[model samples]
Target: MPELPEVETVRKGLEQLVLNKKIKEVLVAWDRIIERPNIEDFTNQLIGEKIDSVSRRGKYLIFHLTHYDMISHLRMEGKFDYVQPDTSVTKHTHVRFIFTDHTELRYLDVRKFGRLTLLPKNTAMDYKGIKKLGPEPTPEEFLLESFNQQLKKHHKAIKPLLLDQTLITGLGNIYVDEALFKAKIHPEQTANTLTFDEVTRLHVAIINVLAQAVEAGGTTIRSYKNALGEAGTFQVNLMVYGKTGEPCPNCGTEITKIKVAQRGTHFCSLCQRIHL
Candidate 1:
């Protein structure tokens, strides 16, 4: 799944390639991908609207159109490709937007788990998906005090707490493991058990990890790609996420993998000790 950085990369790509391009037509090759409104209504609503801008919230892509905001979630293997009209559509191409410039924006999803929904232009920010999300980890609103307060309210393991979208909107398994390792906090450590210093360290680590990931265009673990079909390079800088039995970067101890909250978690046992 594409997390914040990957989604942000796609948003930047769409902004450059599709912005101000009027939609000549919309073809929903897979109706299940449209989560809101009937497929016919969705196609009708976006036909003549222009893509004003593209933005991201958490893992969702927000396409600002003339009269509506199109929310897209690339759940697993979804990707957008910008190409000419003559470009060949692949078997996985489920949605295609024909632009007035004779270009095409295609959505390809091998897993078919991606989703799209349309909301009124002004009410998009208040939509259910965007409204309930917590503070973005990279923003100033995710202050140390605010983070500390949110941590105290959750009694779950630190890893799962960090993954909670209602608490910190953008973190996923990859970044959470990296952030916890950077802060030297074990994934299984209870959230409320974190000391003030630990909380401070974690706060800094989350911001730094996410900012760096966004800078690197996000990690490409599998089939994730940006809107321009470029793979991210952050996977090269990863320390412990997928390095099972590998030497730890900080302590030379072998990194270990465990299942935390049902997600594969990696850590250096010597560097990140559980606080039980």
Candidate 2:
């Protein structure tokens, strides 16, 4: 699944590739991928609509059209490719938006788990998926005090708490592990038990890690690519997420891997001491 940074990268690519282009037609090869309205209605509504801009919230991509906002979630293996009208469609190509200029924006998903829903203009936030997401970690609204207050209310382990989209949007297993490791906070520590100083360090770590990941175009653990079909480079800078049994960068101790909140979690056990 694409995290916040991956989604942002795709948003940027789509803005460059598809912005202002009027849709000549919308072709749905797999009807199930359209989550809102009947397939016939969806196909008819999108025709002749112009893609004004592209934006992202959490892991969802928002395509702002003249008449509607198309919300797309690239769950797991969903990807978008931009090509000329003459380009051949692959077997996995589920949705195709043929632009007026004879170009195409194609959505391909190997797992077919990606979703697309249309909401009326300026009403995308009312959609259930967008309404519940917490403030984006990259923005000024995600203050340290707010983060501290939210942490105090959760008894769950820090790892799973951070993964909650309702608390803080856009953090997944990879960046959570990286942030916790960087802050030297044990993933198993109860959320409310964190000290003010610890929380401050963690807050900074989360912002820095996510910002760096976005700058690096997000980490491509497996088959993740931007809208331009370019793989991410941040994986090379990863410290402990997938470095199981490898020596910790800060300390020589081997990095440990454990199942935390049903997700594979990596950490430098000696470095991130439990502070209760």
Candidate 3:
């Protein structure tokens, strides 16, 4: 799963190359990828609309168009490629946008799990999934006090609650495990049972992990790449994400892997201990 940094990297690349480009036509090769209003309606809403801006909310990319907003989720293997007008369409390229300038914006997804939704212009922020999302980790609204309040509101294990998009958008299994490990908090520990100091440490871990991941263009564990198809560099800096049995870089403790929320979780038992 591409988290905040990976999604943000895609957004930045696509924004620079595709923003202000007028849409000449839209091609939907895979009908299932179109999730809202049907494929015909999807193409109708996007064709001839100029892209005003490209932004990100959680892990979804938001393309602000002239009349409507085109939101896309690059779930797992989805990627956008910018090509010239004469470029040949490759296999697995499910969506293509022909620009007035003779360029192509192609969305390729091997797993075919990516989704596209078109909402009306001047749409309210509370539209469907957007309505349910909590504060962005990087946004000014996600302060330590607000984070503590959110933590106290949930009695479940801290790991799964952090993974909840309603509490904090874009956190996935990898980032959640890494953040908790950095804070020395056990993944299965109850959220509201955390001490004040643990809460403060968690706040710092979330911010630091996200900010650093962005700096490295995101952690590419598998097929993740930028708009240009370049692998991320953060995987080299990871301490506990995928290092299951490896020794921890900080304390030399052997890292361990467990399943939490049905997701593979990696942490250091010596670092993140649970009394329960």
TM-score of each: 0.98, 0.98, 0.96
Better of 1 and 3 by lDDT: 1
How far is 235's C-alpha from truth in model 2 (Å)? 1.0
What TM-score, to 2 decimals, does candidate 1 have?
A: 0.98
Which pairs clash (backbone N, Cα, C closer than 3 Å) in model 1? none
Q: Judged by TM-score relative to the true structure, which candidate is superior, 2 or 3?
A: 2
Pick by lDDT: 2 or 3, better one:
2
Name the lDDT of candidate 3.
0.86
lDDT of 1 by residue, 60-167 (tens): 888888999899989888899999978988899999999998899999999999999999996677878788888888657688888888788778899988887887
- Model 2 misplacement above 4 A: none
TM-score of 2: 0.98
The runs of at least 3 residues in candidate 1 whose Cα sits more than 4 Å from the true structure, single-residue gaps closed, are none
Clashes of each: 0, 0, 0
Cα error, residue 80 of model 3, in Å, equals 0.9
Q: Which 10-residue window in model 1 sums to the lowest lDDT? A: 138-147
For residues 1-276, could you state the per-residue lDDT of candidate 2 as single tens digits? 799989999999998899899999999999999999899999999999999999888999999999899999998889999998799989999999999999999999999999999989988888899899998986496889888999999888999989988878999999999999999999999999999999999988988999999999999987899998888899999999999999999998999999998999999989998876
TM-score computed on alpha carbons, candidate 3: 0.96
